[model samples]
Target: MEIGFPNHPRRNLLKEIEWIGKNGFDFVDLFLEEDMATPEKVDVNKTRELLEKYDLGIVGHTAWYMPIGSPVKALRSACIAELKRYFRTFAELGVEYVNIHANWPGGLFTDKEGVKFQIETLKKLVEEAKEFGIKLMLEPLDTRFDTVKNISSILKAIPELYLHLDIGHTSLYGRKPEDFIKKFHARLKHVHLHDNNKSRDLHLPLGCGSIEWEKILKLLKKYYDGTITLEVFSRDRDYVLLARDKLIELWNKL
Candidate 1:
């Protein structure tokens, strides 16, 4: 399995890429945010040259609050425009997988209507994404939603879609990370590995929280071999490398 990390809020894209290369990471999960690789700010050729220089692979992640299919028409339209630019950037850079959120806030729509609207918007985006040879993974965020939270409900909603499973989010539904791996191993295209206290999204290092990483790592080795981003974060910045080493050590033990 290939293991890597994402950019920090304080750093620039070039600095993050340099760190990934120096630290011997396989690929990078590009978190699209301000001061990072946002739609308008991302330079295509520069991004390509950096990736090539670092010998790195890249996958995209939309910002947590950037909901492209928002229920609000004006905001949703702006988001769609932003995401269209992002998808075009992904294709130009040869990004095969782009993680996207499942739902937006506001309870205006009923469950059935909400799912249908999300599907419609996704299908439209998928049509555009296919032209660039990109597939959008439904990131089932641990939020208040009827259809997109559970693996079973999400699969039934969009059977053709791949999943970008956040390990920490599994705790929100009272499910083990390995359970999703065992059941939907075939459909998981990207993974976000972190830990929490099972009460909130803490983004702690793997073993520092309530997660069972030994069994989780063993299950991961047995069932899946794909890109995993060490999804731990800290303001101190040193925790980034520390967490990466710890996860690698635990992963190696398995």
Candidate 2:
């Protein structure tokens, strides 16, 4: 398995890449959040050179709240354009899998019309990904709106899609990772590892939050053998390192 940490927004990109490589991560999820890794600011040639220098794999994470399924016409159009644009850019940067959230956060979880729009929009995005020769992964948020729990419906609608499971979000939604891992193992390609309570998505480090790590890791080992990203975020970089170590310890059970 390619175990890595998300190069989240902010900080010096080169330094972070250097640190990730020196510290022994397998890859780095290029989290293109606002401000730092936006297509406008990133130099793909230099980025690729650095990644090769470190011998680390790369993945692309679209900005959170990238609502390709919005009901609003203009918003949806902008989202689709952004998705296509990112697909081309990330593929150029050698990102194998590009991830986007299922739906707009803080929107109606039960928005039937919205979900329909999402499926159609994603169909186009998947085709774009195919053109780029990379995979598009859909990540599920905690709420019902555009959730990975709707995996069956989404997959039926767009067969080429894959899943990026966020452990913290699943726990917050009260969904069982074991069940999804077993059922959708074939389509599950990427993962985000972190800790959160039954409440909101805290994005805390492992052991600092509640989760059955051993069981979850075992299920993951049984199915997925691709990239698993540490999504643990904190102002203190050391905190993320600590979380990564804890996750490695639990994952060793497999």
Candidate 3:
């Protein structure tokens, strides 16, 4: 199991990279959220140098603000453009997977329409990605305010697109993460392995939440051929360390 941490751009990325290397991590996911600045601001050449220096594999988390399913054609086009830019950066950095969220509902499209749009959008993105030799992994968000609520929905729409299964989101939505692995096992490309209480989308460390970590890890070992990213995020260093240690333990069990 190749372990990695999420990219919180608010933190000094180089420092974080050094810290991750010191702590024995081998990969990092560069998360691109709206409030966070673009990856362009960070010296890509220097970032790549550091990653190579630390021997860390990079993965990209695409932007969260743009709505790919927007009802307005202009908005959707803009979203696609921004996504392409992110994808381009991922390709340039030699990142393996570019993680994307499914289009939210009530944007420019209904749930069904959003799924259709997302599939179409993915087709275009996949074509573009092939040029860069990058793979796109579409993730299923929990039902909270998110547009894409379930794995089944995304699979039904575009069975061929790579999947990034977020176990914490699955548990929050009262769905079994194993179900996804069993059903979409072949399409799985990466994972966001975190835990949450039964109530919310809390990115808790392993074993602290209601998830069956043993069962999940067993299934992951059986079915997944991709990296397992521990997606715990918080300002507290102790929480991060505890979660990281627990995740390593779970990986050992596998």
> In order, what lDDT does every prediction score?
0.75, 0.78, 0.73
Kindly list the per-residue Cα lDDT of model 2 for residues 1-254, writing each as its tens digit. Answer: 77888775676666777778887899988887677767777777888888898898988898877777677768877887777777777888888888878774244545566667788788888877888888888887767553444666777688788888888887766677777777778889899988888678888888888888888888788777788888877778798788777777767767
Off by over 4 Å in 1: 73-77, 104-110, 144-151
Model 2 alpha-carbon miss at residue 240, Å: 2.2
Worst 10 residues of 3 by lDDT: 143-152
- On residues 190-225, what C-alpha lDDT tens digit does candidate 3 reach at each position? 898777896688887777788898888888888765
> What does the lDDT read for residue 207 in candidate 1?
73
What TM-score goes with each of the models?
Answer: 0.88, 0.92, 0.89
Candidate 1 residue pairs in backbone clash:
none
Most TM-score-accurate candidate: 2
Given candidate 2, what's the lDDT at residue 92? Answer: 87
In lDDT terms, which candidate is top? 2
Candidates sorted by TM-score, best first: 2, 3, 1
Q: Which candidate model has the greater lDDT, 1 or 2? A: 2
Off by over 4 Å in 2: 104-109, 146-149
Clashing pairs in 3: 70-108, 71-108, 104-147
